[model samples]
Target: MKRLGLILLLLIGGFSVKASYKQDTTIVEFTDRGVKKRVTVYTSSKKDFELPRNLNLENVLRSMGVDSSERKKALVLIEQNGAKQDTILLLANDGRTVKIVAKDARDQLSRRDTLRNDSDHWSRSGRNNDDDEDDDDTTTYVKPKKKNSGGRFFSKSDFGFYLGLNNWANGASTVPSLQTWGSRFIALSFRRNATLINGKQMDLALSYGPEISWNNFMFEGNDYIDRSTEQVEFLVATKDLNKSKLVETSLNLPVMFNFGFEEAKLKIGIGGYVGYRVGSYRKLKYSDSRRKEINRDNFGLNDFRYGLTVEIGRRRGISFFGRYDMGDLFKSGQKNAAGLQAWTIGIRL
Candidate 1:
């Protein structure tokens, strides 16, 4: 009877030891600048362990062989036994945090791709999922279509360049003809487009943005622009006006109404822009010296300008644009200056 009892006691002790070893898990808590994070590490052995003493979180991650660049953006977490690892929390610079979890290998490409997909969804629905944690767990992430991806009529933002011909209309007697191909208007802008109506066949949108418009007007014949006083004058050059040109630059705010059809394949925008004169200059090429001379001045140009613009084309295809200024080129009190309104026509790419 004593031998049988001893054997049973030994068997029970051995089973308890095995159970403890199987359940060995270490919970590590990391605190940095009042921010606390926790991770659970499971171990097969029941031996006790401790993290390196007096080490920072960054140093700890480095010791784990994490790249330096990723250390700043990565959140390290360990899985709990039998608990679903369904979401990951991401921190942003503006104190906003987002949660993301990959459902499969296809969704685990790069962080950029993940954020881009989320951004497209947010842009379309104007809803952010960061604050809503109780929604359905199974989210199907389909890569967004590239149609009008570059410049959608209802997109929140887009950027592009503007190129066109620059000329002027004078209300006075007659303005000199411009060098047809030599005169040019060039600009770059950052735009915001808002959807008013999105439909299967047609869409209506509104757009507004800031732009820098550079106007280069090449003269015809021996004519040159002069601004000795409050008035802007057109003077005939003693020498040939080979490459004499006037350049005006302004900072402008443009607003437009846009219509799009067939998934933005055909788009038309009508808008107006208001600008403040930022710079004015003149360039002259002298035949005698065969040298180019540049002069920077206000040139009696108007301090403020307003203009109308029209755009028509395929969203990503070549588009035609036209601009006509409603205000005079120079300030009031310019004698015989007439209308002196500037205009441009060109293609937008």
Candidate 2:
């Protein structure tokens, strides 16, 4: 250690540096005042270039080589590729600096590129302590391990579709008598997730996003919503209809807090959502070769609705979701034969 320190001191103090063989990087650790610091030097052509002979780091950083001086020195690592070179540097608020200077004899770095990229890379405003944690924070070229775990319901973020079936659960009246297979539900949404806890057993995350959903309720019988009354009413169509359905479009916001089990990437979440009806209408198709009929209105449906949601399945793959909206499907205080609330179940991607 003493010999290496003497060698670095001599090299930094405008002396000389010599090594037996070429290496990619040389790491040095030192202390300035109470803080610990580290320097890592690299080279462009490890086999061809010589250190200290080509680098005058003291002049570039305005640092001193004396142990008594608080002006800490840094490491310089250079890499060359064709006409361009890369200089690695550390940016910390403290005096410690690490720089990489790349050589490009044919095509020098533009002044704009130097000022924009290298300057930012070389200088930062943060504490510079001798602690490895502190120095590591100021400079790290390590790439994170990418995870393929961003699924429909468990992910850092995702945008996709949810497709499934629509039906009314816990309904006393007959407002939404939907066909078993004809009623369709779909949601287009972007989900954002934040991890709250991560461990060997499980990881918990909160997810939320805006959703635009469409629900088509196809009546099992020849009935459609009547538009004249203040209360919701199911009216039998005068003609023999091939298809009768009511379509509802809603803008919703849902939040879910989920626990992801480490094994199988399994996840489960329970959350609720609030939504506003954006548009609603009814349609009828005749048995004859007649085009579909259309009528647009609120149809006594509630404009604002809230509901509970459940999500469970593989984190990066298929998932099942269920949603149930609360309260009557109409304005409060209105009475109709069928009082119904909407529910949906489907696969999410």
Candidate 3:
């Protein structure tokens, strides 16, 4: 029994020694004043530390507004030999027993060491430190990555088509000067997008294409038709002379600016365009006042027009829109003539 007890005691003693663990620690020193202050850091968790970490000391320095280059100069390694690993960092605030604790593990120390090395190397070569954890607010310049610089790509281009109703002016001398609207005009257009200033601030677009238009105008004054030479009854001839359709085709160009609101969903812009009349439709009808079948033809008026456009809409790859135009389509002396204008709603892609 005595021999068995001795063996059991020896086994117990062996187990106790194997189970015991001593943690590693560090001491970092810096001058706060003429007095030397020592910062003791505990590394008890370091022995089991696996490195190549996701963290670093640069991030820590940046958060505290510390110069990483200067901080790296103060780092030092101390050998603890067999002493109990002082895993506790005690800063002597005063001279005696009152100490402030700064705790760090092996993983954190490893991260710090990597950051300090990078900073020191950067300072020696006059290069910016690339440590993830070490950021200096004092840095005034940061070189951007190459990919951040703009490159050529068709992904930024724009293209779209729109359809709208237009009005052509009827320039009649006797009619109300402000009454320019005549007949329904149909228009088709294509546009290209330009640069985008900020994510949501400003945009410029350009559009152009062709339009088909029709309008009518009439005027009958005693002086316009000589009274003495008028042979037929006035009432019958006047009705035929005052009514006819004028058709026009034109090529147009427009430049527009888009101002966005509500995260680029809502926008409004104003622009202007000039249209060249490519051709016209000529028709003949009876003149009632002349009391005879007479051909009515006026082909000199529809030549060129210039006008303004205003648009407003919501833009989300597709846009709902409205437009207005203000210009004259006929030459000054041409009777009962007006310009080109339209109100439209359309989408953008």
Across 233-284, the per-residue lDDT of candidate 3 in tens digits comes to: 1122334443333445667776666565422245675677677767665333
Which regions in candidate 2 have their CA more than 4 angstroms from the true location?
Answer: 1-154, 173-176
Each candidate's lDDT (Cα)? 0.61, 0.59, 0.35
Kindly provide the TM-score of model 3 when superposed on the true structure, using C-alpha atoms: 0.37
User: lDDT tens digits, residues 25-74, model 2?
Assistant: 22321111111112223221122211121123432233212131222333
Q: lDDT by residue for model 1 over 190-233, one digit each (tens)?
A: 99888888664567889899999899989888888877776677
lDDT order of candidates, best first? 1, 2, 3
Any idea how many clashes model 2 has? 8
Give the C-alpha miss distance for residue 279 in model 1, angstroms.
Answer: 0.3
RMSD of each: 19.7, 16.4, 21.0
Q: How accurate is candidate 2 locally (lDDT)?
A: 0.59
